[model samples]
Target: MKPKAPNVHEDGLLEYLEDIIGYKEKQNQLKDKLSERKKNMLKQNKITKILKINMENLLKIIRIATIFRGERTIRFDEQDLIDLKEELSRLERFLEIEENELKAIQESLKDMR
Candidate 1:
């Protein structure tokens, strides 16, 4: 014998099914968006860490060069000195920007707390 069809309900089951499907699709979309955002945040964190390390190394190099300049009477190549000076200036500017951003982040964290 053939099976009977499902009985129709007054509660509009078909509309409820459509709403459920729509809500599931929206939830899946939101999950995908959240995962993408998390990946981007991790990538940005790694880049920020690398930049901080590079800035620290640049500062150390500048300090060592300054110390050498003070200790030795040996004449350095003019081009080398000029290049070092330019690099130091660039690093200083970057450090200043990073410092400001770090302070801003700290302040934001404090506010959140």
Candidate 2:
């Protein structure tokens, strides 16, 4: 006796195809988002590195100035003090902005997952 053929439902096929397409689209979107996030993180990392270097240099300058002051060999003019204060304030603002941006990115990543 010949074997009977199996039946294939068109509706099931359509549903499966739709699901696959949706899944693939979702995957592509995720990949794009991850790539963009990685690039942004790398850029941020570079900025952080530069900021770190700047902080270290600033600290070193302050330490040297302190040592010189202790020895009574150097004096900070009013303009010099004002400039240093402005620079420190600028750095503080930059750090606050970066922190907030990082927090936002973290939230976005969590939402993606």
Candidate 3:
């Protein structure tokens, strides 16, 4: 005898299984996007922390320079001051770029929320 063909209930079950598989694929794609967003946010946070620490150091250096500038008795080396100024200038430029990038990342994160 020939085997029975698939019944209507069996066909319905197969269609439901295919739909569930499609839903799972969509769910995985969403999960991956969320994970990438979280990683980007973490990187932004790290950049902010680093920027804060460096900014504090720069401010302290500025204050010291201002204080020492008024002291006539102290023989501060001009060369050392120039070197420090150059280094500080470089750091300031780097910080400026980092701040802008962090701001953009923050805006994107806000939109996602």
Candidate 4:
């Protein structure tokens, strides 16, 4: 005898299985995205912290340079001060950008909740 064709209930079960598979794929994709975002946030935070420390050290150097500017034994040129100030400005801008990016990633994580 010939084998029987798939009944309606079997077809319905197959559709349900397919749908479950699709949902599982979507869930995995979202998890991957969340993991990547968390890594980026961590990296950004580290970069921001390092930048702040460097900026603080630069400020200290500038202060010390100013203190020695009046001595007849030690002299600091105007061009040297200008160069230090320019470097400080660049670091500040870089830190600001990193902070803003970190905030954006945090906001996205919140929205995912």
Best by TM-score: 4
lDDT string for model 4 (49-110, tens) is 67666656865676676687754333354455456567656766765776676567567656
Candidate 2's residue-wise lDDT over 1-113, tens digit each?
Answer: 11332344334554466577795577567667666766766676676667666766765676687787786333454345556667666766766676676667667757755
Task: Give residue 66's lDDT in candidate 3 (0 to 100).
Answer: 65
lDDT tens readout by residue for model 3, 48-85: 56766665676567567768777533335444555656
What RMSD does each model have against the real structure? 11.6, 8.2, 10.1, 8.8
**Model 2 steric clash pairs:** none
Ten residues in sequence with the least summed lDDT for candidate 2? 1-10
Q: Tens digits of per-residue lDDT for model 1 on 1-113?
A: 11332555433555466567795576566556555655655565566566666656765665677688785322454354456566656655655665566556556545533
Can you give the lDDT of residue 27 in candidate 4? 56
lDDT of 1: 0.57
- Number of the candidate with higher lDDT, 1 or 3: 3
Count residue pairs with overlapping backbones in model 3.
Answer: 0
The segments of candidate 1 whose C-alpha lies over 4 angstroms from its true place after superposition are: 1-21, 71-113
Q: How much RMSD separates candidate 3 from the native structure?
A: 10.1
Model 2 has an lDDT value of: 0.62
